[model samples]
Each structure stands twice: as structure tokens, then as C-alpha cells.
Target: MSPEPQATLELQRTLVLVLDLCGTFAFAVSGATAAVRRHLDIFGVLVVSFAASTFGGISRDVLIGATPPAAIEDWRYLAVAIAAGVVTFFWSPLVERLRNPVRLLDAVGLAFFAVAGTEKALAFGLSPLMAALMGMLTGIGGGMARDVLLADVPVVLRADLYAVAALVGAGIVVGGHLLGLPVVATAVAGGLACFALRLLALRRGWRLPVAGGAPPPDGDA
Candidate 1:
């Protein structure tokens, strides 16, 4: 590879790393915020934060055959998550003052992770469609895990446009790549597409249609 191509590749790698870490931090804050609202203990808050932020990336890495996973190999990821947890624990009142902070913060995490996950998947030689699916999973998986831990239905299943937003974002990245866009441009476009769609859904009450005409009996009749 020539000097110019090598430099471009290095720049792309750096952008991906920065975006991935940003997603981790955003998810951590979102998780900690949820825990605070649930009145969880400090340890619980930290655990939720760490799991919410890292597991998606870890799962993606594992599926892509990235041994040990970045979450396991990278100390910064855990450090950022713990820091976010501590901040949310001490700043609960301020966070609560924000209207629906959990939903908003979760949207941010979802967008970032969607884009980052797609890029990482592509980098690891996955097909574009598979990359998009992985991206959607990465965006929503942590939240699902968090909800399960809280004994609540996952937002992706309950909320309208949740996973849809992720899929749109991943699609944007894949499309941009196919069109030969710069890595930074593709990342920004994809992240913004996801974030904007999610926020719009929240504001406009957009939702996917559910199954109907089904009334199951309780406990075998």
C-alpha cells in the first residue's frame, strides 16, 4: 500500500475507535440513569452501566471472531463505564431534572453503537447486510439486557421505531460505504439518521404496528 492509502486507513481506524468509545460512554450514562431512576444500589448502578455499555460491543466482537473482544482487551472501556456510573450516582437529582433523560440518553447510545458496529463489522469482512444486522443488534442488545435485569420489557420490543432506527442508521453506513463516502462522513450520517429518527418517533408518537386479534387464555384455559 502506498503512503496515501495507508494514511487514509489509519485515519479511518482512529475515527472508528473514537466513535466506539463514544458509544460506550453514552450507553454507560444511559444505563446508570435508568438504575438511578429505579432506585438501585450503587453497585447495581455500576453493574448496569458496565453491562449496558460494553456487552453490545463485546457480543459484536465475539460474533466477528475478534478474540477476547475489545471490551475484554481494552481497559479504557471499563474505566469510562465506571466513571459514568459514579457520575450518575452522585448526580441523580440533576439527571432526574431532565425530562425523560433515560430515553434521550439511550437514543444517543443506540445511534452511536449502530454506526460503530456497522463499521466494525465491515472492517472484519462481514457482508454489508450482515453488518447492518450486527449493527442493529449492537445498538439494541445492551438495552435489552438492561431491561431484563430490571424485570421490564425491552424497549426495542415495546417502543415504536426503536430497532427500526438502528437498522436505518446501519443501512446509511453501508450505503455510504458503497457510494465511496469517507469513513467520517458515513459515520456522522448514519449516527445522525438513527438519532434523529428515534427522537422524531419519541416526539411524533411513531410506532410499528402490532399483531392483533389474538386473545390467549390464562394458564391453559
Candidate 2:
């Protein structure tokens, strides 16, 4: 490859890595917060944090045939999750003081993971449709795992615009790729789109219509 192309590829990889790590940390914190809320012990908090941070990425990699996922191969992923977990555990009161800190952190993680997962799926030669779905899965998988571990329904299934926001963000990234747009710009735009949608849904109480026109259950996330 030419120097320019190589440099661009390197930069894209770095961007993806940063996004993945950011998502990991954010989700880890959210998971730890939830654990603390449930009165889990420190070890339980760390376990939940690790599961919530890495499970989605691990699933994505396995589906794409990337054996030994980056989360497993890289020590940084583990360190980041542990650090976030410990911080949240020790500072639960501070985290709790933030308005809906779990949801806020979850939104951040969803955005970052959606973009990063879509990019990785595309790089792995998946079709745009499948890549977008992979991105959505990446965004929601951790939350699902966290909720399940806590014995609650997953927020994505019940929350306002959770999965839809992820899909929209993933679609933006895929659209940009198909249109030959810049990778970094598309990533930022997609992440912002997802995060904004999530926050808007939370504030406006927007959600899909429920079966039998019944009221949707209130989301706990």
C-alpha cells in the first residue's frame, strides 16, 4: 500500500481501538454502578463489570471469525474494565449523585460500541445490512448481560429508542462508507447521532407503541 493509504488505515485502526476502549470503560462503570445499587460485593461488582464491558465485543469478534477476540488478546481491555469497576465501587455515592448515571454511561457506551462494531464488521467483509445489525448487537449485548446478571429485563427490550438508536448510528456509519465519506468524520457523526437519540428518548419519554396499545413498561436503565 502507498504511504498515504497505510497511514489512513493505521489512523482508522487507532480510532476504532479508542472507541472500543471508551465503550468498555463506560459500560464497566455502569455495570459496577448497578452492582453497587444491588448491594453486590466487590468481587461481584468486578465480575459484572468485566462481563458487561467485554461480552459484546467478544461476541462480535467471534461472529466475524476473529478468533481470540481483541478483548481477550489484549490486556488493556481487562485493565480498563477493572479500573472502571474499582473506581465505581469505591465512589458509588459520587456516581449515584449524577442524574441517572447508569443510563448516561450506558448511552455513551452504546454510541461508542455501535460505531466501533460497525467499522469492524465492515472491515471483516460483511455486508452493510449485517454489519449494521452487528453494530446494534454490540451496543445492546453488554446491557443485556448486565441486566440478566442482575435478574432484570434488559433495557434495550424495554427502554425508549435504545436499540433503534444503535441501528440509526450503525446505519449512518454504513451509509458514509458506501458514499465514500471520511472514516473518522462518519464515526463521530454516528456516535453523536446515537448518543443524542438516546438522551432525547429519555427526556421526551419516546418509545414504540406497545402490544394491545398498553403502556410500555417503565425502563429502569
Candidate 3:
């Protein structure tokens, strides 16, 4: 039976919050790790970590009309990011040793952000397309910002499963909404699907194949 709409929504919100926290932690650690590798000062590491963790959610919240945004409103997210960064300074090598696992954690963060962002958009009475777009934005926004700050090309713009996986996950949420699935189940499907797709892509090199077999002519033929 279809769950009460209100109850379903509440559950979805809780799930989203949990996912958001995880994303914050993962991204913060990633940025902090990079800062350590660069021999950045503690202040710089914390700044980058805080930015990495809270920026995406803050941007998502602002777009969805959560005024002041969660990151600015609560302060907990930034505190968490700061704490993680401090710990990372001591354990940076451990993280570097398991770089692949660290990346998988980032993928998990991306999935959670996408799924939760889509659900929030839907709840805010957005059209499905807009909702999905929001999901994509939330999933990739922080990564894009993080890379730009580091002077690297954004991960989402590259030939990777990053944004595409998020898109597919958001699609699941939209489809499930049409099918009248309960919010919890729908969220699980959407988030897990996105996570799986991203991880699988990482495992198998599932990237957008390059277009056009013919090389560009060096000179006019």
C-alpha cells in the first residue's frame, strides 16, 4: 500500500539529511587530503575542507529556497568538516594509501547528493525535469568548485560516469514517483542506483566514448 504522503516525505527528508552529512564528510576529507599532499598550512587545509563539504549542500539549499542555507544556519557541517580536516592531517598517508577507496567514498557522496537533491526539488513542487537538473547540479557542483579551486578540470566535465550516474538516479526517483512508490523505497532505489552506477563506472572505466573516429585533418584536404 502507498504510504501516507506526509510520512513518506518526512522519511525522505531524514534520509536526505543523512546522505548530505555523509557527502559533507567525504568531500571534506578528499579536499583535506589534497591540501595535505600539497603541504598546505592547517588553515588552508581547513578552509578547503570546509568549502568542499558545505558548498554543495549550501548551494542546493539556497536554490531550493532554504534561506541562509543549512551550512550557514546550523554550523555543524562546517564544524564536522574542520574536525575531519584536523584528523586527516595526522592520517593523510592512510587515506593516500587507499586512494581507490577514498574515490569510492566520493562516489557515494555524489549519489547521495543527487538522490536527495532530486527528492527535495520534487517536494518543492518543481517539474520533474527541473528536479532532475537540480539533482545533477547538487551531485556535481561541489566537485566542480573543488576542482576549480585546485586549478584542475572539473570531474563532471570529463569523460566519466560522475554526472551521468546522478542523472540516472534522479530518473529513478521521477519514475518511482509516477509509480506511487513509498518515499523510503524510492529513495533507496534512487540513491543506491546512482551509487552503484558510479562505482561500476569507476570499476569498468564506463565513460562517455569519444566521438568521431576520424581525427581532425591537420591541414585542409
TM-score of each: 0.89, 0.92, 0.88
Q: What is the lDDT of candidate 1?
A: 0.85
After superposition, candidate 2 runs with Cα above 4 Å error: 1-4, 215-221
Question: Could you tell me which 10 consecutive residues in candidate 3 have the lowest summed lDDT?
Answer: 212-221
| Cα lDDT of model 1 by residue, 108-151, tens digit | 88898999899889888899999999999889888887888888
- What is the clash count for each candidate, in the order shown? 0, 0, 0
State the displacement of the C-alpha of residue 167, model 3, in Å, after optimal TM-score superposition. 1.1
- The residue ranges of model 3 lying beyond 4 angstroms of the native Cα positions read 1-4, 211-221
lDDT of 2 by residue, 1-221 (tens): 12327777788789889999999999999889889999999999999999899888889999999989999999999999999999999989988887486678779999999999999998888999999999998888888899999999886786589999999999999998888888899999999999999999999999987666665456322
Question: Can you tell me which runs of candidate 1 are displaced by over 4 Å?
Answer: 1-4, 100-102, 213-221
* Residue 27 accuracy (lDDT) in model 1: 86
Overall local distance difference test of candidate 3: 0.81
Please provide, for model 3 over 68-92, each residue's C-alpha lDDT reduced to its tens digit, 9 standing for 90 to 100. 8777887777888888799888888
* Alpha-carbon local distance difference test for all models: 0.85, 0.90, 0.81
Report the number of the highest-TM-score candidate.
2
